[model samples]
Each structure stands twice: as structure tokens, then as C-alpha cells.
Target: MNKKLSYNVAIVGATGAVGKQIIRLLEERDFPIQQLKLLASKRSKGTIVEFKGKDLVVEEATPESFEGVDIALFSAGGKTSRSLAKIAVAKGAIVIDNTNAFRMDEDVPLIVPEVNMEEAKNHKGVISNPNCSTIQMVTALKPLYDRYGIERIIVSTYQAVSGAGNQAINELIVQTKQILDGKEVTKEILPVSSLPKKHQIAFNAIPQIDVFEDNGFTLEEMKMVRETKKIFGDPSIQVTATCVRLPIIYGHSESVYVELKEEYDLKEVRELLMNAPGVVVIDDPANQEYPLATDSAGKLDVFVGRLRRDLDHPRALNMWIVSDNLLKGAAWNAVQIAEHLIRNDYNESK
Candidate 1:
């Protein structure tokens, strides 16, 4: 395979939020594309999506979809990715999955390009995108971790409803209007859609994001804990998370506290983050400037601000991180891996 050759690309869940963003980015970044295949479930099969000014009809995803695909990006869900990712791999297409299906698989490379892009070269036909929250956190922490050995990380996330899906975003909008208009609030999707209980997200925050695991941590929180270790290639680093759902519509915000093995100067730490790739520092306390969810929406860079030393812990620091969960956190990260694969000629003599 020639690195300069354009390749056939397939996007699973082409009609979904992240899928749509991936399409936009492919065009925005000018990804080399010989052919583009839009795939969705049967319900969304006939839908048409505009890409590069052409209306492409989405086709139902099946095993044959990957026959000539050089790369397949999967974001449908765990079940869909689980059933089709291996099939795509068997058909000779490298699969970049955004679901939780293959992330923890020992053989699968869980990638955050800024943190550990080298891992992508070792992929056995499947690569996993880390959770949205984990993506931004790791992107911000990587520079710090490389400069000062990190001992532990404690993160509390204010995730947007959009992380759940388009439906959740709609629910938040409707719930807000209902509450403002003094109408009855109806809730169906939120917290955990599969769970029987539902909560209002318009005027409130849900303490849970995904289903609770046996360890008393939500699946979303556990993803941050486990994926951080895998992405960093260090199992000794400790991580804890509390994932919460906020009423925001686009970006995810995290309050991250990290304890480093060595003492660090605040000015040097800020300088390191400013120099890191795919990271933007917005800290200007005098001007009351910091990363905000609204400002981060639709951006590809992870925004970090509010860098301050922890009062009690000499080697610890606290910072705020924000990014568009749908873009850099999911679609852009997947596309970045694809770009890296192409640049490195992943298909040549591997």
C-alpha cells in the first residue's frame, strides 16, 4: 500500500452525532478518500447525508460493507461494534472503534494520539478510542506526566447530555422549556437510558453517567480510571473519577487533581502544557480567563486552565480541562489515528 494513495473509508453509525462530526472533519482535514461509505442501522439506512457538497445515501451496515474498505470507523454502540468490528477486521480493514467493546482487550490498542500514538502501529487489526472524558484528560495530563511522574489522578467530570446521544440532548432542551413554562416535565432518557429510573437534567445534575459497576463506580467513571492506565502504559498510576451529567449541550468539563512524584514549579508546569501538542492553555486568573464548556464546543483542541498548586499537597496540582466531547474526544481522535496510520504507512509490510 502506498502512503500517498487515497483509500476507501467506511463510517459506521453515519447518521449519529459523532458520526456526523467525523464526516465533517474528514472533509475539513482533507483526508485522502478514494471512496466514502456511509453506514447505519436498517432504520437509518435510506437517510441521506451531505458530504463535500454531495448527498450520500447511507446503507445498512453488514459484513460485506468492509469488503474494499481500507479503514472503518465504528461509533454505533458496543453491541454493534462487538458484532461487526471483528468482521471488518477479517475483511482486511483496520477498525477504529469508539465504543467500550474492545477498549480493555489486551490485544487491542487503546489510543489517545497525543499520549501514545506509537501503540497504533502494534494494532492487531482493531484500535479502540478512549472514552470522551478520558481523551481530554489524558491529552492535558500527558505533558505533565512526561515532565513530572504522576502518582495519582482524581477527576470529577461535568459531562454534557450530548455524550448520551442526540436523544438526550433533545430531552434536555424539552425539559428545560417545560420547566421554564411551568409545564409538566417528562423524562425518559438520562443517567442510564437502560435503567428503569430517570432524572431531570435541565435544571439539575445527575450524579451518574453510565450504569453502576460492582465497585460502586459508574461505567463512565471506570472507563477514565482503566483507560488512563492503558493509554499511558503504566498500571502503577492510580486514578479515580466521579462522572456527572450536566445540562450542557456540547462540551465536557473536568476538574482534575494530579499528584506528581516530584515537586513542580507552577510557571514551568504551565509552560509545559502550553507547549504540548493538541493542548491549549487558557489560564489567566487576573483576567478571569479559563477554559469554558461553551468556548470549547466544536473545537478540536483540549483546553486546560486554572492551573494552581494544591494547598495541602506539595506535589499536587489542580486544573480544569474542557473539550468538545463529540470532536477531539471522539471523532477527531479517531481521525487522528487514521491520519497517523496513513502517514506511517500502516498497511505496508505490516
Candidate 2:
């Protein structure tokens, strides 16, 4: 019960891919920490993992697991996060959830630090990390939104299989090998494991991500649309998306078209994004270069390219955005919230 912190942090779902990456980022960034805790499900309880030249045993996550922690990072899944986040927050631990648990909660600030760092200070003990696709989109849009004022956004996502999970990553690899060997590809998990119909993602792309809702939009697409408005704090910014699971791994790429409320020259647009923090513009079509998933992998910055204005509508512009889905999309973003807390002199009480 002695949570009198010198930065006692607990990582929920510490055995998962994103959790592992968060641990690495915390260590690599040399985040101020006096104690490090790893918590997973009961099934993964005894697993040992490396962290900053130390071996840490993964404990089963439960309500009591967060008792003495100052900050808790949750990414197990929505169900697990929903069940434990309140418990973590109740115990005086500020929670940064990477799952979609409290994203739509009015009290929680769904944040992307580079776009909105001030929101991090207003936490109700829980801050939601925006969707991977949404994160990159807003990072690319912030400069334009603040300078020219965004009116609308239409995004189509080319997401990697790793966004599904480690099993899905392995599935793509196994299925790809089978295809290359002239063998039949298997299909068990591509677009939601719990759903009735599974699609082959080996050489094909599935246009759906999460299950469909009453409005006919898939949850993943809806997240991109809804979370964009929340992160930008602008309900008037219209957004629609088509989320697809492709054969790639690591980066999530987007083809985003936006119409500004105030018209601006393409040269000014390029200059603004180039000067924006955490965004790299790679827009030189004649040189045969642009943001690609293969090149964006293992990096933290969001890449923007293929920028051009719509010929018919001077207020409209199009561009391509890419970011490591696991890094800036998930782990890095969560770590950034924690960094914001420390830098802003926020206490455990929020």
C-alpha cells in the first residue's frame, strides 16, 4: 500500500506485443522509474521477460495488482482494460489505456501528445490512446487544422496484420509460405476471431476490421471517424473511413483527403507540415520517393507524402500518411502520456 512513488509503473498485458514494446520504449527512453512491474493474464503469470538488463516475472493482473503503482499502462484488450482500469485508477494510479476502453468516455481525454499535450493534464485518472490510424491522421492534420482550419477528412487505411495480434502476424507468415509453395492458404483469423466468417489475409485484403454496428460502419472505421473528432476536439470536422487489413506488418498507412475551411496554397501546406513536430514530409514524386510501410517500420515519426491539391476543389487536398502501428500508434503514444505527466509535474492524484 506504500505507493509513495518514485515512479512505480505497472504494465498490464505485459506479455502482449504492444506491452513488450512499451517496456522497451520506457527502458530505451530511460524513463524515470524506481520500480517496474509486469502484469499479464493468469495464463501468462510465470513468464519471464527482459527489461533494461533485468529479468522481471510477469504477474497475473487483478484489481489488487495496481495497489502500489503510480502509473498503469493497459493494452490487454478492451474487456480486460474495462474491468481493471477503474480499479487501477481507484488505487491512486493514473492509467494510460491503449485499448478502446475509455476512448469515447466524456471524462477521459483521448490524446495524441504532439497534437494536444495540454489535454494530458486534465486526466480523470484515465487517458485513452487514440486509434492507430487516427493517431497518424491527426498528427498529419494538426498543422493544417491549426493553421488553415480543417473542415472534413476522408481516410482509407491499409493496416498491417500485426495490429490484430502476434498470432495474426504468425498467421500471415504461415499463409504466405503456403502460397509461395503452391499450397492452399488457411483462413481462421483475419477480421475478428470471434466473428463467424474469417477472411484469407495471405495475399488478399479485408475491408473490414471490427464487427459492424447498426449504422453499417465497422468498429475500426468508426473508431477512425469518431476518434479523429475527439482528438482534434472539433466535432464539425467530418470524417469517414474504410479500414482494411493488408498483407503488411508493422506500419499503418492511410490515404487521407481533406478540405480546409480556409483555402491555402500547396507550398504553404508543405511548409506547415515540414515545420510541425513529430511529422516528416516525403513528398517528391519525381524522385520516386514517398511514405511506404517497409520504410516506416521500426520508426517513431509519422511520415506524410503524395501531397497535392484537388484540381476541382481548391480547398481540398490529398496525402499519404504512415507510422509504425506498434510504436507511435500504440506503445510510443502511451509512453508519451506518461512523459507528459512527468514533465508537467502531475502527481498521482491527477
Candidate 3:
């Protein structure tokens, strides 16, 4: 868009789980990159990461790091993004933030490329990626929303351990081993790390993800409720979610119930999802085919299955959706927004 052959890219939080995936995707997708810079916290400084067969040292991110950057992909925590995202934008870089810090901000566009990419065109230098669970749900529902008009949405998520980062992944493995060895299982990082209490995520399901608000819904649940309306640009659509943490290591799966405004034929609904972009329908029940976290791990597409009509509510439908929490949910979605900007020549007039 700048009339250059390629752009200079920077990945903040380059040493973390989602950040590492962003690096891999950028390379695997062969994104046009003139220069790739890796930035992380002081603790991660001097760490070496590879890109395109070359080693790149992770640097301590500071205000000066944005100097020559053209596109900055931020997977750092919300606090870091709150502190640095604007500075990067002021330095003439488009920021695709994979954090909750700016998603609901009136000026910042909340984007899931397959769903509401047009909102991204109005970005005032920074665009926000939705929560991991929200991304995959909206992607699979977009086609149906367009055809049948979604009236109400109720979702329950079985999220992976990796959504909490590498530390939580380690905790799950440690606890699993300890329990098997008859040692006291350690509990430290599940549910919420900052809280005084922690729970074992191995061989168990924690009915909470993120802290709960006064309304009794967890932060993760509220994100799906709020972000879905914004992405669909429909406030009248009712949405509620119950997010749960599971022992799985990679994919996040959801059991979703949707009430539509108009009646829908089951065959047409399946056909619509089959034709949707970034969606894979695996609803063959006769052969025991369906979306599974084990099958969806490492994949970029959102896998959907178990589609059926609700018995009591004739206009209602139910289904299951799955995707790699780190890939399609975070890194890949952020990267797709960047690619969309390039393909559409966004901000070229400037």
C-alpha cells in the first residue's frame, strides 16, 4: 500500500506462545516482509528466535522500537498493549493488536476477517482481534447469520490450556504426572493466575475462564457477548456464554445454540457453512465424523459439526465448533487482517 515491495514488520511479545505462532505463520504464509523485528519483555531479551532460517534476537520493547516499523502485530498482554500500541501507531505503523485492551474502544475496529473486515477499514491506526473463543464461533456463524438471521446465541466452550500461555501448559503436564505418581498435584495457574486460588486443570473442567464480573459472567464469556454484537453490527441479537477451561493442550471447542428469526432448512444450513470461507464442515454422523480438538489442533480452519435443529424451538439450531486457540483464534486472525490491509490497499491515500 505504501508503494514498497514489502513492509517492515515487528512482532511484540515475540517470545510467548501466541507470538511464536505469529512468527511461524508469517513465514509459512510467505507474507511479504522487508524486515522482521522481534520484541519482548526485559526478561525475554537476548532470546534467540528463528525466522526464515535466520536467527533473530528478541529485544526489550521500548518506545523507540517502532521507529521504522510498518506493521506491528501485538500479542503481548493487554497491559503492554495499552502502554505501547498507540506509540507504535503514532510512529506510522498499523497495529493489529491481539489483546482485549482496545477491542471495545469506539475508535478501534474489532475484526475477525471472515466476519467483519469492513469495520477494519475505519481503523484509526489500530485494529483489535477478538477473544480466542469468539473468533471461531463468529466465523462459523457468519454464514448462517446472513442467511437465517440469528436472534439469540447461547454458547458453552471447552477451551484449551495453551490459551493461558506456556506456563499453564507446563502446569497441566506437571499436575498430570504428579497425580499419576501419587504425589500431591500442584495447583497454580488455572482459572486465573493472579487470584489467591488456583485449580488443577488435568482430568478436570474448570467452569471459569478469566475473572467473573458482578453479573456472574466471566470476562471470557462477556467478551463473546460484546464482541459478537460488534462484529455482526447487530445489538438486538441476544448472546450469552459459559466458558470452561479443559485439560486439552491446543484447540478450543464450543457447543453453540442459536435461535434464528426465520425458519431454516437443515440441508441448506449445512450447504451454507460448507460454502463459507475459513470454515470446514465435518457433520457426517453416520461414520462418526465430527470436529474434535485433537483433529483440529495445528489447523487454521474452524471445524464445525453436530449440526441439528432444536426440538422445542422450531427456528432454533445447535452445533459444535472447533479451532486451534492460538492459530485461527489469535495469531492467524491477526495476520489475516494485515494481509487484508495489503490486498485492499488500505490507507494508501495517506
Candidate 4:
């Protein structure tokens, strides 16, 4: 454990949006890699992806694909992770899954490195990355939660179209041009692509993300609610969310309101966030300074601003949070976990 070691790494869904970002970060971060494997579905086989100025051909992902991989990063989708994560773990690879497949599993540690790095040490073969929205929210809230106990949370998200994948980004561009040219817009994706109804994402906001459940909450909203409790290891904390998809293309923004168990001073709350790791505060409202999605795009840190106490509630405070959904939300968060494991020589079987 003392000597520097390079790992044989594999990335599942290497051709997708988040997967591509993961590759870029691994190279940019200069992660120790003895060998790298690019994996995708059968349709993406034989595709070429560039890494370290060399072309790496992507292969179809099978159980055997992970035979010698020391770390497997899964970002394809929940279905792919559900089927392949166990196989990767069986082959002695530590699986850091970005999909929701195992986030709620009791044995799987849902990790946001800045929030709860200790939970990762107890993983029994698999660790999960939180949802893009949840990751940024929790990252901003952790300092406050530790200082003043949180009683309840209510959040509304202004998420980017990129969260839906590369296809949704294309749809937004195509639809926008069509509208400008006075041509009929074609809608094939957005809100929910698989569902019968499709909404225009060009200059519009859709109130739904993922499919709606019996409780009138979309799957995405429920993920924020459930994942927050698990990440904090505090089931008593009440959380609610309304996730919305916006026309932007990179960062996800949230308006978060939290009721603290203890009274807090506004100045001290801002000071607490200013010193927190992985959080950047920009709350100078008079100068028109605040965290914007445009400013946070491609950035690794979660941006927090517009800090204030709620007028109607004595113990409640409000803030705005933003981060790159593709980076900190998905790829960067996953890479952070891998780095932590290697740094600590984490035992997957523990």
C-alpha cells in the first residue's frame, strides 16, 4: 500500500456523454492507469475513442470484459449497471456505479466524496454516485448540516437538458433552429422520450424528470429525497423535491430551503460555507454577484449563493446551488471515489 501503484481500469458505456467526460477527467487528472479498457453496447463495438493521443477501440461489454480490471466505472444506465456491476465485482474490480441501480441498496454506499467519504470504506463490492442534483445539493448542505442539525428540506431544481444524455442536447438545438426558421419543430425527446407525450425543450421548462410515480413524484425527485437520507445516514431528515428540466445545456441549479433544528445567524452560515471544502460562495447580491449555471459549467466545485433567512420561518434559510451536471454530478464524482479508494487501499470485500 505504501508504493505507488497503477490500476487496470475499465469504463462501461465509454461512448456516452458522461462516459466521455469520465475518460477526459481520468486523463486530465492523471489517474494511475496501467491499462485502460473502453466498453459499450454491441452496437458501439469497433468504435474508436482517443485517449492520451492514442485511438482505443471500444468493445462490447460482457462479464469477461472485467477479468483484470482493478476499477470499473459504470455510467451507461441503470439497466446496464444492474446486470454488469455484480460481474465486475466478482472479477475483483471495485465498481463505482453512476447509475441508480444500487443507490438505494442497503449494502451499497451512496457517496459524495466531500459529504460522506467514510461511508465508502464499508462498501461490500459496490459503491454508488448520487444523482446529479442530489450530489450538488448535498455537497453544499453538508457543512450546514454538521454545524446546525437539519430538520427538513424543500428543493426545486432547474436542471439542464444534458442530464437526459446526448440525444436531448441535440433535440434542443434542432428544435431551436426549426423555430427560428419558421419550420415545424420535430419532437422525439424531452420530459420523457419513451412516453407517448413529448414536450418542446427549446425555450421551455418541463416540470417533470423521469416518469411519475403513484405518489405524484417523478423518479428523479424521489431519488433526491431517498438518496439524501442515505448519504447523510439520517433517515429522520424530511426531504422533498420538485425536479424540472430547463433549456440550458451544462449545469443543474437548485433553490434549496432548509429548516435547521437550531437557530443560526446569517453571517455565520455564510462564513461556514465559505470555509467548506468543494464549495464556493458568491453571495454579494448588491454587486449582482451570484452563482449562475453558465459560470459553473465545466467547473468541479459546487457554487452556492443568494444566502438568506426565510422571512416567514424563524429557523429556515434559503440558498441557490449550481454545478456541472456532467462533471461533479456524474463523472467527476465517480472519479473522486476511485481516487479515494486507491489512496486508502480500500478493500472491496469489506
> What's the lDDT for residue 147 in model 4?
96
Summarize candidate 2's per-residue lDDT along 64-164 as a digit string, tens digits.
89877888999999999999999998998889999998999998989999998787767888999988889989998999999989898888899999898
Prediction 3 global C-alpha lDDT: 0.93
Error of 1 at 67 (Å): 1.1
Instruction: Please write out the lDDT profile of model 4 over residues 1-350, one tens digit for every residue.
Output: 22248999999999998999999999999999999999999999999999999999999999999998889999999999999999998887889999989999999999999999988878888999999999999999999999999999999999999899999999999999999999998999898887999999998989999999999999999999999999999999999999999899999999999999999999999999999999999999999999999999888999999999999999999999999999999999999999999998767345
Over the stretch 1-350, how does candidate 3's per-residue lDDT look in tens digits? 36467999999999889999999999999999999999999999999998999999999999999998999999889999999999999999999999999999998889999898887878889999999999999999999999989999999999999999999999999999998999998888887998888988999999989998999999999999999999898998899899999999999999999999999999999999999999999998999999999999889999999999999999999999999999999999999999999888677333
lDDT of 3 at 35: 94
**Decoy 2 TM-score against native:** 0.97
TM-score of 3: 0.98
List the candidate 3 regions with Cα displacement exceeding 4 Å: 348-350
Model 1 local distance difference test score: 0.94
Which residue pairs show collisions in model 2? none
**TM of each candidate vs. truth:** 0.98, 0.97, 0.98, 0.98
| TM-score quality measure for candidate 1 | 0.98
Query: Candidate 4: which pairs clash?
Result: none
**Could you tell me the TM-score of candidate 4?**
0.98
Summing lDDT over every window of 10 consecutive residues in candidate 3, give the lowest-scoring window: 341-350
Write the residue-wise lDDT of candidate 1 on 167-217 in tens digits.
Answer: 999999999999999999999999788999999999898999989999899
